[model samples]
Target: MLLDALLFQLGYNAALVMIGAGLLGLAAGMAGTFLFLRKRALVSDAISHATLPGIAVAFIVMEAFGGDGRSLAGLLIGAICASALGLAAVTYLGNRTRLSEDAAIGAVLSVFFGFGIVLLTVIQAFGYGRQSGLEGFLLGSTAGMLRSDATLIAVSAALTCAIVLLMRRPLTVAAFDPGFARVSGQRPDWAEAVLMAVVLAVTVVGLKVVGLILIVALLIIPPVAARFWSDQSTHVLWISSIIGGLAGYFGAALSAIAPDLPTGPIIVLCAFGLFLVSFLFAPERGVLASVLRHFRFRRDVHMRQGLLALAQGHPIFEDLTLKLLIRAGFASADGVPTDTGRARAAKALRDEARWREVRGDPAFERAAARYDGLTDLSDVLTEDQLREVDARIGPPVGAA
Candidate 1:
């Protein structure tokens, strides 16, 4: 069943759903990157919740006017308007009041969402036509959706992605450095408004598929997971889009296989799965790589400490340190130094003495900072510098 759905054999509606959702994810991921960089992720949440009132209000107004209350275009427009109002309120409070942006966001999100709920209740009480589906916008519903609606979502998503691409440079500049962006002929406020507009578009479009509640996850999870794969913003942005697209395609397919499950949550779960994989196994930043680096560091530290202990003729008591010495052929099982062990120990002792002298002289402060007890002095200082430091130590004890 899963294979059939994944292969697009589940039927036309399933295929349409998958394609539309894939486009949505791709756009959301890219837009979400700007939102993430903007450090205003909470703003997306506020906008999404704020949109709900617009949807409900649009429905009520349309019903009163004898128009189709469930019109996608009307609902989305209402959502956009409400989102804009919410953004304005957030901006006003942030700029004028002592309250922080987060606090303003929290207030707007609660009020707008609560008002939406009240409107929904009033619609139900008034016994509106086919008003049952209105609640689906809270969590999303693809079942029994009209072909026209799916097409609209797909087209909107594609257009949103195109718009975002065209404005990428300015959005990025504004997100990271508003002051620099202003100097570069970009109005920081307008660039930021553009970013909010993109996010608002994504949220409004997503309401029919992922719903207002889960839409924020679609906007955030992909970029966060992509960040683990690369340090560069460009790489992260592309990777995030790919990840979002894959999640949407597979999540829609998976949801199709089990009609009882909702597509929004399934898509979110798919994104989280990607995040978990990246966290545990990404090349440079994963838990497995961190563990490997830690083990390697420990080995080096043990070997260095064991060698020095042998040089000072101190008893090797630590089990790991003694085992390391024996494994490296630096000491016998009895903890006595081999000839090679003696040579290494001598070098370790001489390096320690050099570090001691370097630490005492303020002139070598920068060079001395390189001493981590595991590093070789030769690695930190040039030959001439090493020769100068060594001259201070003189010849060996049996010197002629």
Candidate 2:
């Protein structure tokens, strides 16, 4: 019964965290997709760090206006203001100074963060009530979160995600080819601004959990992971959102249960783990799977080469046999290459040829050249198919 209760409680908390973190993740992932595609990922990072000064300045302004209460509203207002300023500064430096974009982001980030730090130090020195509480922004704490914070995060995420969905076509076009988007009169700049707003909002909302230091991980890892699974931009966005959301909630729950566990690192670790898994095991792009496929393909190719050599009367000793072809399944248990195995290999090569016909790739070249202009590789290919493959391969040596 005790174990059941513990498990039950874990499930309950995990569910709640999942709902909130999932929203956060969706927001980050959706917005991050565009940022990654547009190559503005660094700018997002600079904005996240730059929001610190905005939060500090908002606090200062609130105090001056007799609003000493460190309310969420005050923080939001400050964060927005600071983030806008940072964006402006980055844009200005990029336009005017000799500094490159990365250098500009670094400069704006350092300067704004330094200013915020100075203000925070002053607030601490004065021993302002709950002034130390703002430090949570720098190193996020689930302990400080209220239900309202989650609501804010959810609402912001929803709005941002909705905007992304609505503008998917134009935004995708712009990401792939901004010049073309402009020629098509799509207002790529405006599309980019809208996307940047989503990114900024996600950063602000996620600050309650992942903090500024590691929020960029949420914006980067999930989309990158999703890329391994698909070539379509829409699928990439959806998959990235799911992966990012799972990471966020897991991070939040871990931080809640283990007081020592830092939320930022935990969230980052979860996203990174997903990325690593995708890198190693994703069906089409996984390193291990691709390498295995490549090995099998090479083995089959070498086996076919050996068989073609045999058909052309190339001398072969029993002991000097084709071991590589045997290992690749092109030879039988009797240490002799079987017609059935050769046929199967030919079929595989034909399928690859079809893939090339549709996609036009390197696989097509290899597939066409596999039989040295002899076999069409298809099981029941007609004379037309043979002619097509032969036509694709070009004449054999001295057959001009």
Candidate 3:
């Protein structure tokens, strides 16, 4: 059953819902990347929560006017208007007053969400006409959706993705380096406005699919997950979009497997699963990679120290260092240097001497700055320089 849904073997309505959800996911991922980069992701939360009042008010107004209050278009328009107002308030408070943007987001998020909840309560209490489906907007419901609603969602989501792609360059520049963007003739203010506008559109379009309550996760999780896969900005953008799309498509299908399953939370859970995989296994930045790098570094440190101790005729007391030396064929099991060990020890001793000379010499200051104790002297200097350093230390006292 899961496989069939994923393959779109379900009916036409199910296919349409899947397409709409996937597109919404792509737009959210792209738009979310900019917000994450800008450190203003809370703006999406404020706008989403703010749309609730508009939805409730639109329903009441439509019912009073003797029109179908369940119209998707009317509800969305109201959501847009209300969200715009909320965004403006946040901008005003953040810029015109001492409160920071984050603080403004927090205030707007709490107040508007509370007011929206109150409005929802009023509607239920009064039993407004045809108010059966309004609660669907809270957590998203695509089950038994009209064809027009699905089409509208698909088109809106596509347009949102197109707009985000068109403006990605400037948005990225503004996010990473506003000063550089200014120098390049891109107004930081305009870039900020564009980002907000994009996020607003995503929130509005996503209301019926991912819902206002969980939409911010769609915007945030993909980009964060993609970060684990690559350091390049461009790579992250495409990777995040792909992850978001997969989550949406799979989540929608999985929801169809059971009568009680919802599309929104399922999508979020799918995204989190992807994030978990990236966090644990990504070759560049994952937890496993970090652990392996640490172990390799520790081994290298032990090997270097073991060789140095052998060169100086010092007692090797560290068990790990002795193990490393023996494993590398540098020392006998009894801890005495083998012929190969003696050669490596002499080289390590001379390298240390060369480093000391270079560090103290004014002429070698720049080269010395790159020095680490583990680096061989031959790697850092020419034969002439090595000879000069070796001459100062005289011949090796214990040469074979």
Candidate 4:
């Protein structure tokens, strides 16, 4: 049953919805990479909330024109127009006023979304026949998605992907270093405009699947989760796209299985789950990995300090430290420095001496003068060379 559902063997309607949702995920993930890198992640949120007014206006305008207010194309056109206006407002506020980009985003998001709520209430009061299902666009409902809607989503997603692929290099350059790109004769502003257009397109197309409220999650989460897995831009893009597609596929499938559930929140929750997993377990970067690396570093430093103390003929204070050093072949069972132990101790001493010199310690300067014209202890000294300095210095000051 699981395999069949996964492979889309569970009826044509379910398959269509799943495919559309997956494609939407793929496109959002790809475009979101540039958005994430440019630090415009919240811009997507503003744009999405901004679309709500567009959708409401589109429905009202269609009803006035004696057409069905729920016509998908008219609704989408309204969404696009309203979103563009919102984008312009945000840009204007950011450029012309003292508002920062985030402030502008927050302003537009709240104001436009508030206006949309008012408009929705007005529409509800007007008693339009098609207005009943209009609220579905708020939280999204895939149960109402027809084959045509799925096809439209698929085409839009494909177009968005194609644009990203064709302009990948320029987009990457602009995203990473716009000033350098402009100096190098590339039109960074133009590339950025094109990228924003792609974002708008994806946002518009995704309205039916995830709605305006949760759509930003689709744009932001996958790329963030993918970041935990790779540092390279190309790899991040691929991983993000895969994560997004999987989230869409599984979220839609699960929602379909449980007919009472809404699809948009499910999809966002699935993406968030993937993000949590990445945060906890990704190699080298995850929480567990970072903690392990910290402990390992402390252990190595502790063992190195023990070796240094032994070289200075100081008493070993910890019996476990002595046992560990002997087991590692750095000391004899009698707690005395073997040849390997002496060599390791000399290296540790040189490292400490170099660090002290870098830190401008007067003691290290005086010690250096005793080593026959050595002005800087920048390089590691031989065992004999280090021993001569150590003898002159008379064992680091605190050694017991």
Query: Which candidate number maximizes TM-score?
Result: 3
A best-first ranking of the candidates according to their lDDT comes to 3, 1, 4, 2
User: For each candidate, what is the lDDT?
Assistant: 0.88, 0.74, 0.89, 0.83
lDDT, candidate 1, equals: 0.88
**The best candidate in terms of lDDT:** 3
TM-score of 2: 0.81
Task: State, as a TM-score between 0 and 1, how close model 4 is to the true structure.
Answer: 0.84
Number of clashing pairs per prediction, in order: 0, 0, 0, 0
lDDT for each residue of candidate 2 in 1-400, tens digit (9 for 90 to 100): 3233223365554445546677788878888888888888888888888888888777777877888646776787788778878988898898888988899999988888898899888878877766557777786666656667767777877887898889988889999999999999998989988887878888888777778778888999999999999999999989998889878766676666674766788878989999999999999888988999888676556655565544444544443346755665657555555665556545544444543452354434554455433334564345676576557755443111
Residue pairs in clash, model 2: none
* lDDT score at residue 172, model 2, on the 0-100 scale: 91
Which pairs clash in the backbone of model 1? Answer: none
- In terms of lDDT, the poorest run of 10 residues in model 1 is 391-400
lDDT of 2 at 258: 73
Candidate 2 ranges beyond 4 A from true positions: 1-18, 315-321, 325-382, 385-400
Window of ten residues with lowest summed lDDT in model 2: 1-10
Which regions of candidate 3 are displaced past 4 Å?
358-369, 377-399
RMSD of each: 2.9, 5.9, 2.2, 6.0
For model 3, residues 261-334, the per-residue Cα lDDT tens digits are 66789899999999899899999699999999999989988899999899888989999999999999999998
